[model samples]
Target: MSSRPEAAELGFGDIEVGQVYEIERSFSATDVQAFAAVSGDHSPLHVDPAYAAGTEFGSCVVHGILLASLFSQLVGMRVPGRHALYLGQDLTFRRPVLVGESVRAIAKVTAKSEATSTVVLNTEIRSSDDKVIVMGTAKVKVRDQVRESVAAASAASAVPAGAARSVALVTGASRGMGAEIARTLARRGHAVAVNYLRSADKAEQVVQEIVAAGGVAMAFQADVRDAEAVRAMTQQIVERLGPPTVLVNSAVGEFANRPIAELRWSDFEDHLEYQLKAVLNTCQSVHPLMKAAGAGAIVNMLSQVVGGVPPNGLADYVSAKTALLGLSKAMAAEWAEDGVRVNMVSPGLTRTEMTQHYHERVFKMEAARTPLKRIATTADVANSVSYLAGDDSAFMTGVNVFVTGGQTMI
Candidate 1:
């Protein structure tokens, strides 16, 4: 396994779904004997090589429970790190692990419940041959010590008094996918500016949650389509947090879905203002800050509807999104010289409050059609945005990341 990050570097807030941690060790005869001595399960198959060979033409096997214990090490020492209390585990021994064979145990966060401060991890142990030997799930409760450690780490890692940590401005972040993006960025150590047009209460709630999670964040209101409003909002963020080195243009205005024949030009114009003009306003406002920093990332949120035509009534929405894709590529090319990168994230029908009114059958059909057999969630989209916002994609620009579960492939 790779070297573990410092215990102070991790907390429940830092845990992300699909994050993996692993550790490996080779068990020896002495280890097996020690286990046998401790548990008193001195079966011949485990302690006596000759008797084991007679029965199964094999050598001594390590105790299944002994191998399973590695999971405790993984969850308690790594991953959540230092403050994980082993709640319970369910194990299934898939194959026998021979003594003297190296085994690697992996723990992956599958789900996290912030309200309860618990995380569910998928655990598996594999032999050196890369064959699974044991598989299971673990439940753990994270303690307040981890939270305190995270707060201390955040403060310790903050830039000097005059300098600032990289700030990320997320528009329309009061709810849905935008809210998740704000939280995720904060967790990743970015000071976040959560922008909302009207959801003041919800926006404050997001900021409070980030603060509670030991991250830095503040809330601001702005109509992203208005150049003056965006300028004012950006200045406010700079004064309160820092110049935004990352910008996520997720602000959206309401528009009706209507067929081209039924739609007026005003409908198309409304979407254009929402999708294209809003992106333009935020990008232009942050360009100077990014250029000064010699680096920046901009992620534009688009819709999967642009991939193909719907059955009816989405021409205006789809057209504006498609245009935004083109505009993003143009901006990428224009800003390459200034050390700014532009990208787009197109998400399929995600189950946000905005889409809750979607018919049940529509969701089921989309799920069945998707290769992953599931619809996208807000976290799923936020994960993609987080990836593009960080250094993980430093070499990438002008790319469209589809969070569609393979529903739309190009």
Candidate 2:
């Protein structure tokens, strides 16, 4: 290990907007070779001078990540120092760094989040000639072990004061699990928007219930698969209540068990349209709004059938849910640094209106197989969504909470 002095740690309270810090260094060929050896990036343009000379760069170009690694040092050894945990980085490589070129990694605090204990920095690396070679934003969570632990413990029981009265949008809230989720969120101090595509009467009834219970809520009609309709409904919601900072995706179509040979490809497509397509539209529309607000939560509804041992004749339903699971993870990874979280709740067979038609034996068998000796209820799934939407799960993302009564434990 190199004998470098440790930088002073800066707490969350110590950070401020416009504060600047920088580190100067010269990268050599040996550094490139060492990085390549560890990273396994043996690209000719980075390791072979002869090959590099033939390219437009005309020299061995340093790995973009290798150059960007300077920001890591700046964050860990300076700025927020040892107290900082790097969350994510978004960068643009404007110019290449030639091997042996001297450069400076500069960091300036652009924003800070007391709620999340995160700080956003404008980070860049410049050549000796003062030309910027790389530039981007870096987000780091400033950690204070004792304080964080206490806050986390308290959050488990109550909502963060700042989250009170925040707006939530729950799709397919006309009835079923969606209605439960909307009502639960409203009880947790969120003004809710209950969305339904066609069941206007039922949606309005859910809204009226929330209002009678001294909560704010309204019904919206939109085919979530239709992007334009979703936008229009969202606009109306913003005008009436507020831009939703929390979204619960609970939209789904009716379940019809059919053999593969008897089903058309359109059958599979329809399931995807309801489950996956709706999420895509809502997420795209609300992401910018969430990013601007500096905090958001998206709880996607999935079925534990994807956990394993999928039943027969559910190819369409299971396949759509699996795709949704993957998409939730991808969105979680992409949006974490924005203080926007995406999580999935996959509950075991629940007895809602959707499954009311199933034979009594199906429910009995499911409950018997589960460790809890009972199938899930709409309340069980809705309660889990409430936890994920609240600040108690602030640091969690890219996670699938199996709310299956210990039935699908990994």
Candidate 3:
């Protein structure tokens, strides 16, 4: 084993913004299997060929969230280490990543915060071709010696102080899990940009709820799939809701229900276009702002299925979700030194519209078979997402917390 100090050992005095922290971790088919065994995400895109062959990609791919787990290692050990607290991250999957592929995680600190003890990182994930498969921003709490020494000696240290509210642009806030996620953030007192594709009514309702519940929120509509639109949306959110320091990517489409054989290439790309590209567009759009502000958080939703899942019809769905995992890890590596904490939450089966149909057919069996003896609720997943998005999980990044309830033991 290499004898380098953990990331926490590296002092902030020796680092500067824009410095690159590039690292490589080889992931094998067995590694993926191991992750699946521990995470309970046994989706076929990362495993079964019989299920993957009929999909548009025509090949099995690695689970996106499994790749995302690499982010924790990058942040917790490779880049920031002991001094880091994972604030949040935003991720986009640009391409399909297959098993046995050598992937790299790249991190660059783009922003730093003295008062909040944080940094914002610009992150990227690439394959051997140097093609970016995933991109996102990670907001990390770095130990600022100036602040630490002051707090340690100050007599008023016990007084509760209000730090500046951190914000983020979350897509797909019309309803379902995205809305719930937004509400969770608002309840945590975060200022939020409730992004909606076409659900103005739903988005507005969420806004009203946040306001009524004594939280801050605003509704903005953007088809996150469109790059230009995402750019415009981020700008609007910054103007309206203050610069977004945290981003939670919870957007998904209803088309995720079908199996691979019945899946059309257009349907596959459409999902990719909206779910994956939307994240890229938003992160890229907000990255400069996060850097300029000196801190930010980005959280991308990854599924346990990306690692391995029982036989299900969703080859394309699994492929896209699997791709997301790799993207999260790459960003965590590239952006950590810049003061950004990148991490991921691989949620097990959760009750959401996406799983409504699956719930009817397989959830009962899934719950019965699961060690937890129940499917994960939206709250179950959201709690972890919120923690990663806040100071509660400050010492984390480039890590994937398997919220599988012992489905996978690793």
* Local distance difference test scores for all models: 0.84, 0.85, 0.73
lDDT of 1 by residue, 1-410 (tens): 87855553357778876689999997898999999999999999999988988766388888988998899778767867677777777777988888888999998875554324556677899888888889876777777675656544554554333223778999999998899999999888888999999999999999999888878888999999899899788867765565688999888877665677899888999989989998999998888667645689999999888777654688888888999999999999998987899999999989987888888999999999999999999999998999999999999999999999998889
The estimated TM-scores of all candidates read: 0.61, 0.63, 0.59
330 Cα displacement, candidate 1 (Å): 0.5
Model 2 agreement with the true structure over 141-185: per-residue lDDT tens digits: 878776566545554333333445478999999999999999999
Better of 1 and 2 by lDDT: 2
TM-score of 2: 0.63
Question: Which stretches of model 1 miss by more than 4 angstroms?
Answer: 1-164
Give the worst 10-residue stretch by lDDT in candidate 2: 154-163
Supply the global lDDT for candidate 1.
Answer: 0.84
Compare the candidates by lDDT and give the number of the best one: 2
TM-score (C-alpha) between model 3 and the true structure? 0.59
lDDT of 3: 0.73
Candidate 3 lDDT, tens digit per residue, 1-410?
99876455554544456677877766787887888898898888877777778888776788777767666667787567777778887777888787777889888876554335556667888888798988877877666576557633441342124423567567887787788888888888787789998889989999899778777777888888888787667656643445677888888876556776788888778767755787778777776666555556778887787665544776776777767777777777776655566677777877777666664657777788789898787777777888988877767887777777778666
Question: In candidate 1, how many Å is residue 186 off?
Answer: 0.9
